[model samples]
Target: MKITVSNWFKSGSPWVWLNAGAVAVSVVMVLGLLALIAVRGLGHFWPTAIVAADYTIPGNSQVQVMGQIADVEEIPAQRLVDAGLPKPGNKALIDRQLIKVGNRDVSGSDFVWVVKPWLQNVSHPKDAIALERREWGNFYGFLKDVRQNGSVVASGTEAWAALQDSIERAEDIYSQIYKIEKKEIGHINSGLERLRLKERSLELKGTNTPEALADIAASRAVLDAEYKVLEKELGDLYAAFTRDSIQAQTIDNNIVDINVSKIVRAYQPNAMGFFGKVGFYGDKIWEFVSDDPREANTEGGIFPAIFGTVMMVIIMSIIVTPFGVIAAVYLREYAKQGFVTRVIRVAVNNLAGVPSIVYGVFGLGFFVYFLGSHMDQLFFPEALPSPTFGTPGLLWASITLALLTLPVVIVATEEGLSRIPSTVREGSLALGATKAETLWRVVLPMASPAMMTGLILAVARAAGEVAPLMLVGVVKLAPSLPLDGNYPFLHLDQKFMHLGFHIYDVGFQSPNVEAARPLVYATALLLVIVIAVLNLSAVAIRNHLREKYKALEI
Candidate 1:
């Protein structure tokens, strides 16, 4: 048996099995982590039953509490006493629950911790409502009545049904208001800014003559007229949206008026059926993917962050690919294999090991403060002080990342070029092909797979980088997307959002820590999926190229 084991080790079978076991363990660990995230993150969208309970204190009157159960934990009873809460008994361990008693406008807090033993009565009221509002996070209450123009139109059993209908109508009007504000008015504003810049340019060149001034005036007049019309329409829409309101009674029995337009969705999770829940879950997932964030990014969707991350990655790929490939080709095909070449190659390898934040600092100084400021001074003087490209933005961010990942591509491409047999190049040369033609037509094609492999690795690393992006371009919230319907649809100078930064900000910087926790996991899962999708695409192309060049290699 000892001889057999020794022979297996000598034959490398044991090493192969050890490596296979390590790989299997890694995959399982990764899947397990993803599963945990999915359960916690995706479950956030599901409507949880709101509980109404009477929380009793040792000396004070009983207080009614209502909200979803957000989290639970066990702690030593001594800890509660140390924290100034009255200890119930001499028990070593006690259960504590964090309740999401959202009504931040009234209570000033969305979450509160309560000792489970201090509860007098705990119940899930069927009539209880959980209102997802555009502001104030959420409101947990009972629907008292629905009103239109300050008169009660719905009460008792009819209030719930009426509230739903009013919300639908309000949402429709809200959509119209959004379209007018972001699209129609946004376009007019862009045009007016352009006209202002044009006037400034003409003035600087001493071309502000009567004819030019008159034409500018005419264009401004047209835009001003359009803006006035849109402004009036927006006012009318807002008035219509605010016409309906609902009166809701909090758990403490205070009646508050809530505008229907402010509510995103309202449903009694305790009363919802399976199909109802499925429908609600689907809607929430869609909203998370499509809508804008609200409540300091603790609530609502992350669409802007998603769009920004994908857009930045694409721009980085476009900028990096050609430059990396070209540099690789020059080094491998043209440059002599000597000491200087070896030194350059060594420096390129060293660059890959540099901290990513160093690249951010470099980009900020050279690209934004230097190159961008010069360009603004030369061609965009009218928009000076405002900075435009002379700030951290999409273009600078892309360029910085391209520089960071350049070394990886260079190394990969060179290895591929080296792997191509010298016989292939010599044969092409013998067939009356020039050296340039031989290198381009024969050598580069085989190296295409390696180029893609480098890109895949670059994307995987760049997509998840938050520290570098925060300095270069990523913002907590971007009002407008980098790509829009403006004259130059793709705005390289615009500041943009990113998923990695969103996760960091929402997870760490949010005032409501408990509320933002699940969102952190969800955003993280989404970022991983995005990187995986991009890497898989490049990998597929690489595999195809390898297959295409297989016969030549053989």
Candidate 2:
């Protein structure tokens, strides 16, 4: 029997094949994108060999260049000529390389582009050093001497080991200094602020008696004493931290002195073997995830951003789930199927399509200004003018996201509630169960999977949202996590960092474009992973709920 093409079309086979092919293509594209992001982002951690070379342009003196090869690209020779650089030969296209010369304090730039044809006698020197610093970006050079108290203690090859030892000592001192300044001193400052607020509150209430004043003064004195001790300790640490210094020679043979305390890590990349490079890569990856961002977010770790993002999503989930479920229940089980109900449903659906920035603006107006200002007046009048809750913060950001995602939850839950067989409700009624009891004991339980489905979708969308968070709470840098070891451990009123905003800042707002570009990809990959993890958690719960209720469906 011959099968006609028309008959095959009529059988819907062509449509099925078309759909499968389309889905396959989409899957491949998504995987390809992820692969590209992973390669570009993860590759940044691998230490590349630093190349030292003499570069000369036509009729110009040769200049020494030393740094890691950051990027290589081919462009039309005309483009280089337009920039007043001599074109090489008659080639239409030429390759150029971006070199990270480091020594930003001396050169005033982190990177430089050089035409490949002009580079001569490139070599990777074994003694060359790459120093990652806390400021002024990286430094690439050769160690000359190690100094203690401005006196030379070690020179030549001995300086390398001495430099490492001094770095370790400085790091130990820095750890103590960090603890005192950021934690102990910070705690003392908070205490003083609280005391001041207490005194203010008493004055406001007409209870600023002499005894109260005495007690407040005593507390202030104690805090002041503690701060003084910490200040002395910090001074001593800083003195010690600046004691050790290293002299190094740049590729141009210029000698410079760098304080040991400023260096985060130093390594000889050209001398490292495969295993050594692997270890270095692992350490870099760890630092990226665990350390706080530095250098306008072009360097350091994004731990704070990760923390804020997760905390906001969790808070949003807690607030939205119950409210969404309640609204869905009322609409699906109790509300009359009238014009108002239909209109409300239409409005809910329409809200899901609104731009996210609109929700941010609404949150700023309604949630932050109006509601938060009222809250401050009612409960925190002593902290007035400071606007405790009347600002963009974690709570406002979470609530805004909850509102943005509420429609999804409502629709999903209503669908679940509607799927129940009428006979199930009838059986419950006949069994003498009240409507509320039926909903509590059976209906909601059976519909939990769908609610979770909604939550999963909500999280997936909310975690990746940048615009709404930017207005409500996210910032370029957050000095502390929203959660900390302070009183009222979780401060919902505090502004916090977020991964989405970090990516935006690093990609678009950073001053060092070459340094920040790789980080942008890294941060984007991290955001995708975070959203995935949140969704997968919800999905796991949803699958469990579905399995538990499978028998009831029959």
Candidate 3:
């Protein structure tokens, strides 16, 4: 056979052209996605402008809409008194209310001010929602303070302490009720004991003579009379206690009473910043990251979402890495290439192809409902009918993702194992190294990059998954952080917020969908960035390993 080698390339091979076309299409798709994210996400930080305004009440009872005030300066205290403005709260003479008396109707409706320049003489009084003429920096400064100081800038803690004191007060009230109820319960229980004693005594009545029987009857009459009195007292006490507890609880849980304690313990600076309102927004991410879920608008920002996303990814990584590596090692290093092995491999691959939504259902049905219900039955019989694992939870979500990504890890690892020379294994055996030692010390180090590659892919997939999480563990909002200061800190069964789902919720589920559209784009951009960062870091680690092992040509 004459072996002739040609340097010429194939000009018309459809396979070559087809591969190039595929690569081009992939590149375009990736680049387009990146561009879209950048344009929308990065745009959220741009500054917006605001205008000044003045309002005047009509002489007649009508809605008055008025405009521009001519250079209305904040009246200093002395100026305020000279102008005869009301001096309320703690302020210098200039601490009087701000007002603007403009001539025309071209007033500012767009720009906002917290300490708005109120016209000293109000011609119109309908507009109470006065935006101050304070600089936007005031808003940013307020947010910064909240971020640094954490809710209590001044009397926030006092308010919380007062609330706590109220809670203790409620406890005292309950204790008093319990004490009252205890006396009645004791009487009822005593009567029951007497009745039981009488029953027992009757059993021995047959053994006694006529004189003994007469004496027993007399004693029984006294006990029976006592039982009637006890029963009557218990009935009265139960009725009274039931009514009292219900009444007290109604008072304890009163909207006004609860809000009063909340009001006392709440963080309400006389001059509130934008962060103060973040809690008021009632958003889930804000609740974890800020103090007042309702009153806090910006203070309860997305920091908690960032924290949670990172934490969840870390948890998933921990769960998947070891099991994945072990499975791969078994398949490639030990398993025989027979019918069973082929079947297992096929099953693993098929598992990867399973819809993530299906995995979520599996997690909910098996992990949460079946397993959790069983656990509750075994451990917490007292709390029956309440779920243990029957509720959606973070642990189930993590485990589900781990199972979902297991195939990737296994396949990559097996490929890496196959690439290692059989001679290396033989050589290690000849040198008296055990198979276990060789596999652990030699095979593992070489296959690390492949293992990491699998993990990276798995993480990317898991990070963006929303449908599965929606069914299994994701909640619209949770009052407490999944990880918190509570005992046994990481509450895995607790539900959590996610950026991917947040985008969907804000964009679709929000009452003000139009207002939330921009936020949706921004959230999507952030999620993509997070996933990219994780993937890039994993790739960097894989590269480092590749460089480290270049000398050991597998």
TM-score of each: 0.98, 0.98, 0.56
Candidate 3 C-alpha lDDT tens digits along 207-249: 4566656766676677667667756765664443332110011
Question: Candidates sorted by TM-score, descending order?
Answer: 2, 1, 3
lDDT for each residue of candidate 2 in 57-164, tens digit (9 for 90 to 100):
878899999999999999999997898888898999999999999999988999999999999999999999999999999999999999999999999989888988
Give a tens-digit lDDT track for model 1, residues 301-389.
99999999999999999999889999998998899989999999999999999999999999999999999999999989888678878
lDDT on C-alpha atoms for all candidate structures: 0.92, 0.94, 0.57
Candidate 1 regions exceeding 4 Å error are 83-91
Q: lDDT (0-100) at residue 363 of candidate 1?
A: 95
lDDT at position 326, candidate 1: 91
Best by lDDT: 2
User: RMSD of model 1, in Å?
Assistant: 1.4
Q: Tell me how candidate 2 scores on lDDT.
A: 0.94
Give residue 42's lDDT in candidate 3 (0 to 100).
44
Candidate 2, residue 12: how far the Cα is off, in Å: 1.6
Note the clash tally of each candidate.
Answer: 0, 0, 44
In candidate 1 the C-alpha lDDT for residue 141 amounts to 92
